[model samples]
Target: MLLVEDEDSLREILREFFENRGYEVIAVRSGEEALEVISNKKFQIGLFDLKLPGMDGIELARRARENDPDMLVLIMTGYPSEESVKKAAESGVYDYIVKPFRLEELEKIIEQVTKEWRMSRENRRLRKKLADLEGEIW
Candidate 1:
């Protein structure tokens, strides 16, 4: 898991919280750091605060998707403008939570996305097996 927030306090809190929940978190301060980590590592899920210092969360998500299109990404923001929310929503972000978000709710979103990822991975494997079997049959 990757957590990106410009606020040090918030980033630490989220990192600790997710860690306590058994997630290996790579928490960072800016979207620049987030992008670097995303490009280098394969995290199951990424949580980004919308207004980072160097790059906004939306753009970070875009770049992350470019690196790994199946990665699950969640966006959080204290300042949720209509345009930003709409834009992020359109980009297939996993979920959005406003600041002061409840830990329980965040857990639920994580669980939901994890479940979906598992199913998608299983489906992909099955499809590949089917294709390979068909090729062998011919």
Candidate 2:
């Protein structure tokens, strides 16, 4: 996973937290850098700060989804407002949370999304195998 935030303190803390939890966290300070890293690498999820230096989190989410429609994005913001929430929801983000968010809550969201992704993939594989077997028998 990749984390995008400009705040040095928060960025460091979250990096340590997720890394300790067994994620190979690539933490970036700006949205532009985040996009560069993501475009080259394969990441299971993204945690983006809403008020990024080069690009806002909402726009980042939009572009990332365009590049990868199944990308699971969780947007974070210290600034809270109805308009921001509305815009984020419209962009097809997996989830968004206002900051001062709990690490536990973030972990939970990440875990659930990862689990769902795995389950869906496994189900698809099983269905494909079943179809192949039935065709061979017929």
Candidate 3:
């Protein structure tokens, strides 16, 4: 998982929270840094702040998805606007979370995303296995 938040305290809290829950989280302070990390590693999920110093979350999500289409991205914003929400959806974000949110709420969202991600992964694996078996039979 990749977590991008500009606020130092919030970033630390979120990183610790996810880490304690057994997520291998790479936390960064900017979209630029997140992009750099994404270039080197593939993440199953990404949590990005909508506002950042450079390359806002929607753009970051778009670029990240270009690298890994299967990645699920959730955007967090203190200032939620209809325009931002529309843009986030257009970028294929899995969800948009408003700030001042409860940690439990975030956890529930993560759990749901994880379930879907696992199901999708399993489906792909099964398809590959079936294809290989068919090739063998032929």
What TM-score do all the candidates reach, one by one? 0.94, 0.86, 0.94
How far in Å is the alpha carbon of 49 misplaced in model 3?
0.2
Which pairs of residues collide in candidate 2? none
- Top model number, lDDT: 3
Q: Write the per-residue lDDT of candidate 1 for residues 27-77, one digit (tens) a residue.
A: 999888888788778877889999989789988988888888888899999
lDDT, each prediction: 0.88, 0.87, 0.96
- Span of 10 residues, lowest total lDDT, candidate 1: 35-44
Residue pairs that clash (backbone atoms under 3 angstroms), model 3: none
Which ranges in model 1 have alpha carbons more than 4 Å from their true place? none
lDDT at residue 101 of model 1 (Cα atoms): 81
**Candidate 1 to truth, TM:** 0.94
Model with the higher lDDT, candidate 1 or 3: 3
Residues 1-138 of candidate 3 have per-residue lDDT tens digits of 899999999999999999999999999999999989999999999999999998999999999999999899999999999999999999999999999999989999999999999999999999999999999999
Q: lDDT tens string, model 2, 1-138? A: 888889999999999998999988999998889888878886768888999897899899888878776678889998988998888989877788888889998889989988876787789899999999999999
For candidate 2, the clash count comes to 0
Q: How close is candidate 3 to the true structure, as a TM-score?
A: 0.94
